[model samples]
Target: MTQINITRVLKGKYTIMIVLIIGIILYNIMNDENLTFTENIIGRMIYTYSLFRNVVSLTNYEEIEKFRSNDCSIYKNLIFGFSNKNELGIIVEHSIGYGENQEWSILDEYESLEIENIMGNRHWIEIDESGELTDGISMDMNRELHKDEVVVNFIVSKKLLENNNKLKQNLIRPVKCSTKKLCSNLYFDESKVKVVYENDNISTINKDDKAESPGIVIYVHGGGFVFGDMNTYEKVLQKHAIQLGKLNKPSIIVYIGYRKSPKWKYPIPLEDVIASISWIHSNAERLGLNPNKLVVLGDSAGGSLATSSIASCLSIKDQSKRRNNNVLSKRFHNYCKWVDHVKFLGLIYPALCQKCVTNSKLKNYKFGFLTLSSLLWFEKQYQSKYIESYFDWRSQPLLAPANILRKFPKTSIVLMKSDILYDEGRLMYETLLKLKVNAKLRIFSGFHGIYGSSWSSGGSNALEFINSEISEIMNQNN
Candidate 1:
């Protein structure tokens, strides 16, 4: 080879070596045990910028426009990554703004006005009738009003959801249950069923199909408050329901489809939970549900919501006693009565406290890649003032006052030893116990998503513990 070609090759090899060394150094710094919060934030920023740069480099503007198209299902697939193995047929119903008919807009007048000015001199100035803000920007008007309005009645088969390794790897994926004889899609409303006996005659009815008053379990799934949907957790919930049924304790599991953050922030998810519980309470008699036997179960971010919702209910009840009446607070005070029916709460590897992230026990606890930067990113999307008011108990239930903690119902918390939030869960459980609240803590050995992943044996154990507690509560109520 010529000397000139050899020199060029040598320079290229040295350049590659330098890049690799820099990458290794950055990785080590990011994972450093003694890294401060500021350092962590900087590391996360660099990591995010690198990822964005790579993505932009790979896709051209034309391809980006195509991906942005409203008709393109790429965004849906990207967000909801579950697979439909077989032709699993299911029906979904969509409604707008609770019971009222309301035309929803994606961008408000402010955003629309801004975008209109951007396309002032452009030749392609078209505003679609179906809430398309721009050519490629669109929004689901129905979802904008409220997510609970969108309901699904479908049966998930065990065979259809039989452990797909590929699907499990993806954090976000669609899960569909097969429409075979094993399961049937069923819908139940207040009109379909009615309470067989009055509240005074609770024990008089037989434990048969007609007389049995099934307990209701409202499940809230977890996905860091941003990702996840009913489709992702349908199988897991169905399995829990079937298992509960086998114990001769029939129960209806209602999977809550709460709105995610960035679009709907803070108290919005909690509001949805309150609304769902209110609807369930109003229709408890017709749904053959024991109004006194409601249980709220949540995992991860859902756990935070569950704790916050319970706390909010207690706060409303206490505030109602005072004479200082505001219209909004009064409405909340009335709504809080419905949540009073909740008898038990179950949390699985829950994110109870944000402050605990930097606690002595958890400062270096690295499991998932959700570092301080990711938390800040989510906060930006959520449009929260948490950065300024970091110790808000609504976001961190562990920081709640003793009175609120004392009012918690019979609680069961399941924590994984390998989880970053393990210490936070332990702290919460301890606080609950200290307040003389009926609480149980179960610790297993695995990472954060183990319950949702292949290591779900721990989840079964957690379920058993929860069921046993529920049974005890039921007997006491009886």
Candidate 2:
């Protein structure tokens, strides 16, 4: 060849060399980066295709779909069948299993075959028929290849599942504390005091000791009125308990753990909380607590409970009953003594909108996303002849805070910008203001339970900010 022709050929060879080098670098980068399952699979397929470019057949979407749907079992046979000309078999174990003694036979898989992922360390070949993967065994999205369909076994904490009878001991529960500054040496009487009484069933207490008091903050946790206990909110209580202790204006917090749904629906839990407050007011002296200082706080469904409890306390009927019934009078006198009873309410993303009138937030959890079984369970709990007639397709106005705004204490509410229950808090606060009930609102940048110190969404400072705000309000009221 002429010298000029030779130079041109050499230039082409050099260009090819550069391309190969660049391709190898890109492959290494993709493998090193953490990727989603789909992305990882796509990347691997691309890499594999590059190795056997000429042997692989390129097809359109329709053809690919046809192959995928047509006798997947027959395709299964093709997967084990010999590789196309120039194609080599890579021993990849499928999440699904092949027979133990049965190795997939594809024309020696062309060149090489080796297992990558297998079922339970068991030997099985992944049959890559066409381009799609078909493992004899089903695999979890996490790539947890199982021998059979059975998943690996695990257990919930026994300490967590137990009745949590000993509140003092079960301090490690989810809602036990909001901060280390909150939880320390917490305990409550394992005794029940009458709150709701066809006869008697409930307990409550309050206290404000200037020393070592986690100033009395009454909390109502949300579990859709079905499942939840004082233990449910142990963490937040513990954190505040410690904070209050540090402040010297310590608090004797009280919680009215009420009967859950199905057995007792609607006003039952509300009555229980109100009655517990009454009992606390009456028994404050015995418990060494201050009946004078109290704040009501609730979250999720419990927000509805908290709002209703305050409404009940403010009711003209409840006040009259206390006046007539000396027993009732004495029990709640300290709590009711105030021209400003129950200084403040801190509603944390309450589920106040029970009507479910197609709010935008519902789109995220439009169906049973929040709790499939729990929602069904709640329906079952309240499904009775009397309740059926009383409750309509829409939730009762009594269940919503907007309806009870006529008489409410000065309230501060914290809401999540992205929470489904955001409007509940907003509407309630707006309603309270409209009704001349003093209210403050804070919209935080996070999801629900932003104030909590656990597997929470975000905004870690929410708990501290609210606590400080509540303390300031209580001091002002005092």
Candidate 3:
């Protein structure tokens, strides 16, 4: 090689070394403010280097093909990794979001779990009046939907959905396949979700059509996006439900479910959350719930979905922006129309950014049960192969534009001072304030999560605070 070429190569090598060295400094240097008093020093240190096995279940290539659409077991044991996997700490490459880059798999009992399709959101085929594929998106405008116990399974249209859009399809390429036939056969396919309903009684039995509309609190559970379910979270779910039931007005508690990852990623799980809106709205009466009076409550990863499940659907009225894929875009537009009725949003320590390495992450990485190491793993499993997926505003709501932030419903955020996500939670609050959204924030002195496990004094305090906040918001809306 020439002398000048050798000089350039040396410069590149030095630059890479400098970047790697800086990343290690950030990873190992702990921030003092995020530390807590004496407790589990070794256990926490162990957790810092280890992750729940299910979080990385989909990272294996062969496993991805075995269980195409099943979520991993919530009980998977923990796995340890000595090397740092922080976005800046260690870099892995050669990525693609779709087609020959499939990185997903399943849980052992995923077959039964797939029954979350209580909405019949599968195999929805739409043909035109002439017995051919419908030209555009069309739902049965005059169809009647039925409710089963606490679940309702409804089929949506396919014609308007097959076409690809830049933002959504980029993360969900397989949503629509190459064959024209495959395009027509695509369904939202949320069959793998685990739905939770507080009541099984059908309102239509003897209900008055003109009776007052009941407010709906749709709760989404958080399991680091790997291991939470309505079943496992029954305690907190009941807590939120029972507290909300005491309101002066009639209310319904709907715990919505979505596909989980490393089995499902990005737009897929989000689509299930969005579909809950459509399904509930369409069958609100039978379910005795009012879609117009929705109040979303989500914790942790659920908080992220609860935020985007509404924000991403916010009025895309400017048709020109997403006109090419009008089906999903139209769903987005329509979701916004009714979304204006959303009364409030309750988020607890929501994971907001994909790439941001905040001070809290650096400080609380060891103490927080959900360490930065585990969080980065969960994020990796949740993201698409596309590099842009990391920066997508839907997943990283903290990075969203001002107008988007302004459109959020009255929101309440809960942050734990010694948690890895504390800084980002505060950032989300500050951003909302800058945009003038009616947002509220609460800071607790606990670690990352308390609700998912045994409810402690901290959990009780947090729930009480949230309950009071909900009561106030409900009173205002009333």
- lDDT tens per residue, model 3, 229-346: 5444544554555555546554445665565665455655665566555555544544334556777888888888888767666624323245555444433433344566778888
Candidate 1 lDDT (Cα, whole model)? 0.50
What tens-digit string does per-residue lDDT give for candidate 2 at 303-350? 777776666444433444555873444323422343245777888877
The collision pairs in model 3 are 70-106, 118-153, 119-153, 119-154, 137-160
Tell me the spans in candidate 2 whose CA falls farther than 4 Å from its real position. Answer: 1-215, 317-340, 365-388, 391-404, 455-459
Give each model a TM-score: 0.60, 0.50, 0.60
Quantify all predictions' global Cα lDDT against the true fold.
Answer: 0.50, 0.43, 0.51
lDDT of 1 by residue, 1-478 (tens): 6456643532343433443354456655655433333233333333333333222232232343332232113212221234432322122221112322211111111211244332122111135597465433234642333333423222222221122222111112222222121112111221122111111212222323333565667777776666566555654555565555444454546666666553445545555566555555554554345677788888888888888778866766655455355333444533455667788999988877754554523443343324444444444433344324333466667787888789888899998654667778888898999999989898864445445332234545566677676666655544
Candidate 1's C-alpha runs over 4 A off are 1-209, 324-334, 360-373, 386-392, 452-456
Q: What's model 1's TM-score?
A: 0.60
